[model samples]
Target chain A: MERVLFKPLSQVAICGGTHGNELCGVYMLKELPRDRSGTFSLTTVLANPRAVDTCQRFTEKDLNRCFTDTLLSDLLTEDSPYEVRRAQELNALLGPKGSEATMDLVCDLHSTTSNMAICIITHLNDRVGQHLFKYMREKIRSAPVRLILLTSPLSEGYSLDCLGKHSCTIEVGPQPHGVLRADVYNQMREAVDRMLEWIESFNSGTVFEGGEVEGYSMVEKKDYPRDPETQELTAVIHPQLQDNDFCLLKPGDPVFMTFSGETIHYEGDELYPFFVNEGAYYEKNTAFVLGQKQSLLVPSISVEKEQ
Target chain B: MERVLFKPLSQVAICGGTHGNELCGVYMLKELPRDRSGTFSLTTVLANPRAVDTCQRFTEKDLNRCFTDTLLSDLLTEDSPYEVRRAQELNALLGPKGSEATMDLVCDLHSTTSNMAICIITHLNDRVGQHLFKYMREKIRSAPVRLILLTSPLSEGYSLDCLGKHSCTIEVGPQPHGVLRADVYNQMREAVDRMLEWIESFNSGTVFEGGEVEGYSMVEKKDYPRDPETQELTAVIHPQLQDNDFCLLKPGDPVFMTFSGETIHYEGDELYPFFVNEGAYYEKNTAFVLGQKQSLLVPSISVEKEQ
Candidate 1:
């Protein structure tokens, strides 16, 4: 059996296949040579084995959603026939015992409900996080990717969020059933390569000067609770994203709005035009795409990554 | 043996003995009759039997953190073990199975690390959430409650934030060897009674027109990652709230600040003296809670909750 070998001094631990259906990262890892050749070793763990076998997002539970210290420990001990054991196995590998080697960076690859482009999910206040965010903007500014949603600290408690540091979830577009799409796979590959390059540069004494980090306007996750009586869509309007017309918006901005006209307004000083697609406004597929109507007219900022 | 009763019409579920050592809620539930027979019925579940038997917080996992959909399902499955079986049994009694029987309130009473007063945990959104926040403010107006740190929606995925609605974790402080102090217990009792009354008023078509609903300065969770190498506390300072005088910070002001000193100041248009605590300016805690320093004198503005 070929084993996944990582670089001894690798500071980052990038994992995909956390949710079995989100396999773009897994395929990318599979394509890489088994040995990293000491160029900052990369170890890839296919998180949920059973789920992967079934080509399902998860077997019993959303593994990404169950990363709290308590839940992780429980899965480690409990005896059951489920994918949690896979999660436990991966956790042990990632969080090795008595090893001072803590991951300085973690990128959990995922796919959203919409066919959006690449996005880097990081905490706003992290220097390294900001550095990576800036680097992505510089590298992939021309992609169909629109706005990078800054998840309010309150709404971030998942795998990357639970990691409690410069961990981010690089969201590719929505999953394509059991098979990986060519575009998404390529995009994931490119993103991983770029991230690895950035890590190498940082380790080799390259300076990552920070840039003007953009704050995300409130993008509320709309919940459509089925009506108990009718079992029909009750049209629950959760106005999570406050539309800021002053900030420059692009064509593919991820807008969270209710079918109703209730919209959240951006309070920042700048005003930008709003973008909209009339037909795909309400469906989950269209609603989750990242786009913007106005373009940020702010001065170009530079970010430096240091070793 | 007293049978555990399940009630759904009542929008309340009282679970005690989650932490075996701090079994105040357990004893309290036992002291009360099986059925309180109030407008809101109460269904009590003993979260961990093994933990309770061993007198510990948990046997293998912290029960409070194991409230995800998957874990709940695992607990409900027939072949599950002790805690999982108990969880299943409890779910049959209290899970969000029946549409009409969905629980609107869950009071997870817990003891904390300090000797502070009672702390109510609720999302900054939901009307009931606001009601609880206001109730706590009214209950301990002048008491040395230290600080009412609003757990960002990003902290606990099982919290009201993930519920995408409203829920609170009431931390009754000064746990004496994993047990609640007498005063803390009294405070919990009073707070629960008041909260119940508020809920009753809400159910009877009586709106809680207590006062103006305060706006929350939203903070992202990822921005506050603990440094991997230094292990030092870190957070993204929302650009809006940096370096500005915090004027007119009432018990319920939603102050939002970014690491870059940008301040998003919003309060009902009233010019009030903002207070600041310079000594308590540590990470995780509020920037204004350090010590008494020069407070901000700013013109207050009136803002309403975005419906």
Candidate 2:
């Protein structure tokens, strides 16, 4: 277990209400106390406040998808989307992303209608993210946890998590918008706490060992079958696939069932699926994303000694 | 069996999309072919077209609840609610409330997030409604079926179903708003077909048996536990009660669980609960409605022979 020496994580942020309708995160923010410890600084943000007020995911544009470097630095006019301006403000606050002055880590919270139990998503090839996901999977005991690595570069990353130097998103689900479950709320609370604890342990001189970690790397997305003429959906998620996220999907397996009582089978290559049958993704026509199994050997690291 | 007779049902209307996000009916309307037969004329309505287009429950006000006589006859200024005008227009087409020219029967379609399987909601004291529900229960074997009797006067009815001479609402659920499932859509389709079949049978002089029918009569509503200071929800539906609609809720049974993981038990009299934990009802602060089991002996009836 060779350790790679690095600077201690001194600046951390926890954000929620990125999607106003997702209540687990929105309410979790209210319960989190502001913290300013001697070792590190903590910032908690309520993202997309107007959307939360109306219980709408977003007013004009989705705030979660507004954090790309291009969008963050873009000039804002009076007619600019509300989320774009909000993203810029966020950049000024915790990000100005890709800069050395940026926050050490940002943990964005989300909830999905899809039965993705507990998903920790991070940027691929980031050694810090890999170590963090491994820690989360080990510490989170109440629910099944899985990590997804996005291959997109940080500058091209669209989610709010990509705004920090080191970042990840915690998505808990089988929960609906504007609705909360005690189990889900508990899951969210524990995740945030565990994340904070990990940061504290790292800053206190605990070394993270290098190891091969297992996760999913997305290959492509699958959209719902729709009527070509009307563009209306012709089928829905198959009974076999619904609520069975992260299951390996094989060719010729039932993926959808048409309104006419016909089963639509999967013809694509075998892959593990996540984000299955999300209600929010209905607007985007995405049924789910297919992923290939991945194993990454993360680098071991430690906080750099002060001075 | 001797039977009281009425005129044959010649004109019937089936309406969908009264609340547009409920997609079971919206798509069902598209699937129905126009019928202009010798025995009966079938008219299928896509109610609230604008709402359906936007995939919202309603643009301003709920269209399903906008069909009361007061709203239908109210003076329509340019500033009136869109649903009000639409209700008036529907009244002119299929109704002029309490008039002999009203449609013979109206089957308004609905879907809910609550696990109320196949709910046939009708006006209390209507023999036609009782007979229809009895018939639907026997015919629809793919799902569980239940009937709810509204105690309100027809004139005071707040739903689109009240616009006809004999009307009932076919509510199927646990379906999310804006998301359609093959199972739910199939249930909706079957319910509509059976209702129309019953209508034709009654019109052709089939005798509906006099018998005791069991159903639910709503007694009161229960709102979610909320923070007294902020009015934000403090607890969510307990896991035991979630998706357990139409179940006996006894005193001391867990109904809610606070975010802090404390169980909130039911303190009221024993009753059956339905429409439990509906997301749409979140806006109204209604967690669920309690009902008392009811038994009504409906009289045998037959369509009066012409002349």
Winning candidate number (lDDT)? 2
User: Candidate 2 — which residues are off by over 4 angstroms?
Assistant: A35-39, B36-38
lDDT of 1 by residue, A101-187 (tens): 445556777753243566676654444555565677678753543345344451244463334235656777533333343445556
Lowest summed lDDT across 10 adjacent residues in model 1 chain A is found at: A273-282
Q: Show where candidate 1 strays beyond 4 Å.
A: A1-9, A75-83, A96-100, A145-156, A160-165, A215-219, A234-307, B1-307
Candidate 2 residue lDDT tens string, A125-200: 6667777888888888899888899898876888888778888888998786767766777888887788878888
Clashing pairs in 2: A4-A300, A6-A304, B6-B304
Compared with the true structure, the alpha-carbon lDDT of candidate 1 equals 0.46
State the TM-score of candidate 1 restricted to chain B.
0.57
Best by TM-score: 2
Judge candidate 1 at residue B17 and give its lDDT: 72
Q: Model 1: per-residue lDDT, tens digit, B124-213?
A: 333455556565666664333222324445223443113222455565644332322334555566666666766565554443344543
Per-model CA lDDT versus the true structure: 0.46, 0.85
Residue A203 lDDT (model 2): 89
Best by DockQ: 2
